[model samples]
Target: MHGEPADEGQYTVVAKNPVDKVQASAKVSVCTKSKVDKLADVAVNIGENARIQCQYSGIPISTIIWYKDGKLIPTNDQRFVITQETPTLSVLTINNTDMDDKGVYSVKLTNTTGDVEGKVNLTVKPIKPAITRDLDTSYTGTKGEDLILSIAGTDNPYPTCQWVKNNTELTPTTDPRIQFKENKKTNEYFLIIKNATQNHMEEYQAQLINVSGLIKSKKNKITIQKQPTFIKKLQTIRVNQTDTGKMECQIDALPQTRVYF
Candidate 1:
C-alpha cells in the first residue's frame, strides 16, 4: 500500500474447502510524515516578546524541536516558551527579547514515517544610542604632546562619532592634527590630537548619531601649557659703598610667570 489517506481501508478474503468455508477480514491504518506549510519571519523590539509560528500537516506527529542559528534550543531555558496550539500548529515565544535573540530560528517535526523542517529569521529593532563610559571632565596636556579623548557607548546599529570643539565640528580634513577612530570590539570612540598646542585648548564633546537617535557626551575641557625655560641667566653687578646694585634675568613660560629676586 502507498500508505496514503485514500489507500486506508478494510479487506476481506474467503476460502472454500471440501466441506467448510472460512472468511477473514483486516483493517489497515495509514501514517504520513509531516510537511511544513508556512513559516513567516518575525521582528520585535527589545524588551518585547517575539513570537514565531509554524504550521504543518501530518497524520501522527511524534515530536517537535526548535533550533536557533542551527543549534538546538534547550528546553530548560526559561526565556523560551513552546506551545502546540493544535496538532498541526506550533508556536515559539521568546520573552524579553534582546539583540542576542536575533537570528535564524528553525522548527522540526518528526513522526514514525519521517521528519520535516522549516526556518524563519528574527530581527530586533534598533534603539536609541546610549553612553556607557563618558569622557573625563578635563584633560591636561603639554605643548608638542599628543592628546586622546575617548568615550564608550552601546547601540543596536553602530553609530557614527563626531568630535566638536567650542561648538565647531572637528575633522581630519579640516585639521590634519586631528583624527577620529573607533574600537568596534569595545564600542569605544576616540578623538586624537597630534602635537597638541595652546590652540587645541577648549571645551570638546563627542556626538553619537544613528538612525534611531542621537546622543552627546558631557563636555570635556582640554588645557595646554608650555614648560617654562630661562632665556638668560641673572647677572650680578658690583657697586661702591652706599651705591645701588642691579640684577636682571629673562625667562619664557606660558601664562607669563613673575620672577622674584
Candidate 2:
C-alpha cells in the first residue's frame, strides 16, 4: 500500500519461470489531507464590510463553502463575495452589513481526503441611534415654579437631549434658567425650567439626537397659570359732591380669576 509521497516509487516484481523471467512495475502518489487554519473574529460598523479569512492546505484546494448560523449562504448573493488570495487562502467578504448579518460564520474547505472547517464570529455594530418613543405632548405648571419637561426615547448607543422652546433651541448653559438633564437608568431626558412664567407657557419640545439622526418630539404645550395681572390700575373720579363716584380696574389673569370690590 502507498502511504506517502516519499513511499511513492516504482515497485518491480520479478518472477522467474523455467525458461523466462517477467517483471512488472507500478507507481503510486500520496498527498496531504485537507486542513483549515484558524480564523479570527470580525467586527465592523453598519454599512461597512466584514471580511473573514482562513487558509487551507491540501493536494488540490477544493471548493469553499460559507455558512451563517449553520445555514448555507448562497454564493449568488450580491452582498456576499468569495475571493482567493492564494492557492491556500480564501476570504469571505460581506458588504454593507447590518445587524442582521451578525452571527457565527463558518467556511468549509472540501477536498478528496475530507472536509475542514473554520469559524469566525461577525459583530455588526450599530452606527446610528433610533428614536422609539418621543416626549410627552403636554405639560402643566404654575407660574413662579420649577417645571420638568421630560421626553422618553431609545437608541442604539444612547442618545443626547436638547430642549426647544417656542421654536428656539434652548441651550442649558446659555439659556436663562433652563437646565438639561438625562437619566441613563430610565433613558429619560429632561428640560428643567426654573421660575416658569407666562413666557414659558408656549410650545415646548425635546430633541433626542445621536450619531444616526435627530428626532424632535411632538409639540408640548406648557400651560402656565398665573395670578391676576392688572394692566390698568384702579382709577378714582369724584363728580362734584355726591354725584356718582365710579371705580374701575383692568386686569389680566389666567383661567379668568374673579374680581370683587
Candidate 2's residue-wise lDDT over 52-125, tens digit each?
A: 88877777566778899999987678999888899888888899886789999988878788787778899988
**Weakest lDDT window of 10 consecutive positions for candidate 2:** 127-136
Clashes of 1: 0
State the C-alpha lDDT per candidate.
Answer: 0.87, 0.80
Each model's RMSD to truth, in Å?
A: 6.4, 10.0
Q: After superposition, how far is residue 7 of candidate 1 from its true place, in Å?
A: 11
Instruction: List, residue by residue over 1-261, the lDDT tens digit for candidate 1.
Output: 356788788989999999999999998778887888889999997778999998888776647899999998768889999999998788999998878899999988898888888899999887888999998999998878899999999856778998999979998887899988899999999999999888888999999998789999999999887778888888767889998887778886665787776
Name the best candidate (by TM-score). 1
Which residue runs of candidate 1 sit more than 4 Å off their true CA positions?
1-20, 30-41, 44-55, 60-121, 231-251, 258-261
RMSD in angstroms, candidate 2?
A: 10.0
Best by lDDT: 1
